[model samples]
Target: MLRKHLLYLTSDHLFAYLWQAGSLTPGPVFGADAAGLRAFALWLADGDTAPACLLADLVEEEFQRQLMPHVGGHAGRQMRRRRLHQLYRDTPYRHASVQGRASGGRRDDRVLFCALTSPAIVNPWVAAIERQGVPLEGIYSASLLSGALIRKLALAQPHLLLVTQQAGGLRESYFEAGQLKFSRLLQTAGHDGMAAGIAGETERTRQFLASIRLLERGDLLHTVILAPAAELDALRPL
Candidate 1:
């Protein structure tokens, strides 16, 4: 069967978009409640409950990423996961997992590691989707998907930041050499006007990149921002 529907589930909203032959057709965005979410998703599927890839954009501020020395094969994966587990043992999140991909052009074949502090909120949706007969092809976080976009963009800047507006807040994903290095969710809402609020958050993200050494003093930092046209225009000058 051809899987063409993409569902993006965030903390408060669920959005359905169409995907066909490398193009995306944006659809409706609705609440995350089972009734509404299922209705819209089925509508997008043309009332068929066939399997589709659920590209979940989780808003939980728990995703972490890093670059590490690459080891080859299955053993390498195990080693990386173990290292990530150890790193998060002291954190408040009790459950987590590590996933990695090879960093580009590194002579030593270093890999980029991504650690996710599992969101407990998504558990209910898992059952909801199953009950509704929506076959779940896969669930993914924004950080992971953003990496693919960064690589696809083939940005000239080695270090860059991508900020997208989501239901709960602004989601920021950091890319180094087109590899996902870090991600965070800023819950900045209603404190100020939309434009200023986003601008302040962008500055904070830049500082974060600098503190982590992903950006150096006076180094060119490129940002790819995804927002509505009005707010996007305001961000253009920043």
Candidate 2:
């Protein structure tokens, strides 16, 4: 049986987990420090070379939405690479994806460029993985995973706002016509008054969308909160 590894990375720590036979076993947590990085490398050296998927939930992640001239084949990929480099020159952890095509005359493709702006936080961890010869499947962000979650849940809202509580904090992702348009993270101090906090953040996010013209005046905004059953029960009233 092939065992899979999952790494949840935040600014403060990296949590490792083992997945086998549909069960997940928690592993050691490595803090974001010199000693922690060294320990992580040593741990990897002793563990099996199972392919790992890194999920980063960081405040430094950035996203930009733009419409680019539609092109295809090799040239299109080259163009996107150049654009992504131009957008985030300092970070190697950058990705670009074409969401859809615009409706207007040129019908340009809608591109979303995302990156972890602060390489200082992620480089050490990646370097450790490289030094240990670990096969990293790919690095993903919480916001990116939320899109997958929406698809898995079969959410078909045209204008949707998805809020999720993660170890790092509250992640709010906004989608237009079922495509992710924007996302932001808010770090809460504690679990106290979490429901109120969610309500306040949702309203603020809605206002931000309207200000950016993403949400039209008086248009309906469908908001979905993803959490465990206990958390959902607490949030249901708001």
Instruction: Give the winner by TM-score.
Output: 2
- Give every collision pair in model 2: none
lDDT of 2 at 32: 91
Worst 10 residues of 2 by lDDT: 187-196
lDDT of 1 by residue, 1-238 (tens): 3647777777777777777777777877777677775676466455566566765566454544455655677876677667666766543322233344444665344444443345455665566667667777877666677767766767657778888776656778877666666788766673235567766777888897889777899887687877776675677787
Model 2: lDDT equals 0.88
| Candidate 2: segments with Cα more than 4 A from true spot | 190-193
TM-score of 2: 0.94
Global lDDT scores for all candidate models: 0.65, 0.88
Q: How far is candidate 1 from the true structure (C-alpha RMSD, Å)?
A: 5.1
Candidate 2 local lDDT, 156-210, one digit each (tens): 8889999888778888999988888889888876455567689888999999999
